[model samples]
Target: MTLILWTALGYLLGSIPFGVAITRVLGLGDLRQIGSGNIGATNVLRTGNKPAAFATLLLDSGKGAIAVLLARHFGGETAAMLAGGAAFLGHCFPVWLGFRGGKGVATFLGTLIALHWPLGLIACGVWLLSAVISRISSLSALLAAALSPVFAWAIGRADLVLVSLFMAVLIFARHRANIARLLDGSEPRIGRGKP
Candidate 1:
């Protein structure tokens, strides 16, 4: 029951839709009507509002981190992992948005960082390097997420491997369209706006 409550809390936090709120508050119009129509920082950037995009990124990441931290404080590592995974689910399938939401990249990294900072940093580095090489956001995110479980194992965090693998699977599932585009060479590069 306590774990259930923590998971609920995590989901609620992750479903806040910071991108929509920030864009609407700044009079930038509805986030859903712009770019890829994704409620993530990458889509937020399509509005040409760097500050709003940055804010959305920070808040989106913070929600995942906070969920993990809070659960860990109250219920130990298992709860923390469950809560973090719940948060990622919420981000990807937010109930408030008719179950449609972001791809979970930022939230994934945030949850990873909260669970284990070194692993998170390494994942982030992988993402950065991939992005620089491919200039493709989805590909970079996929690469980072796919490698996280391996990184966790290599770093001696066996307990975290399953959670990392779970998140990676979900991330890949959510980015199905992007994957299709990637395969066909039609995916847009970073800062090139929506595909």
Candidate 2:
């Protein structure tokens, strides 16, 4: 019951579409109508509002971090992991968005930071390196997500490895279209706007 409650709370909190709300507030109109139709920072960047995209990224990540932190504080590591997983799920399939939401990369990173800062930092490094090398946002995200489980295990966070793997799987699933585009060398690079 405690796990269920914490996970529910996490989902509810995570489901808040900061990207959509921020763009709307900024008078950018419905965020879903533009770009890839995704309510994520990358999609928001298509509006050519760097500040808005940055804000959306921070808030999206923050919500996941907050969910994990609260669950850990009240329920301990196991609950924290559960909450983090649920939070990631919420971001990927937000109810308010008719089960369509972001790709979960930002939320995954946020959960990693809350679960284990060292692992989070390592993941960020991987993301940055990949982004710099490939200039492809989806590729960078995929590489980082793929490496998180290994980092968690290396850091003696066995409990988090499964969660990391689960998040990685979801991230990959969400990027299926991007994966196809990548294979065809037709995917849009970061800062090039939507593909």
* TM-score for each model: 0.97, 0.97
- Model 2, 69: alpha-carbon shift in Å? 0.5
Backbone collisions counted per model: 0, 0
- For candidate 2, write residues 1-195 as lDDT tens digits: 999999999998888899999999999989999888889899899899999999999999988899999999999988999899999999988999998888988898998999899999899899999999999989999999999998888888898889999999999999999999999999998888665
lDDT of 1 by residue, 76-183 (tens): 888999899999889998999999899999999999999999999999999999999999989999999999999999999999999999999999998999999999
Output the TM-score of candidate 2.
Answer: 0.97
lDDT of each: 0.93, 0.91
lDDT at position 166, candidate 2: 98
Whole-model alpha-carbon lDDT for candidate 1: 0.93
**Candidate 2: pairs in clash:** none
Provide the lowest-lDDT 10-residue window in model 2. 186-195
Worst 10 contiguous positions by lDDT, candidate 1 = 186-195
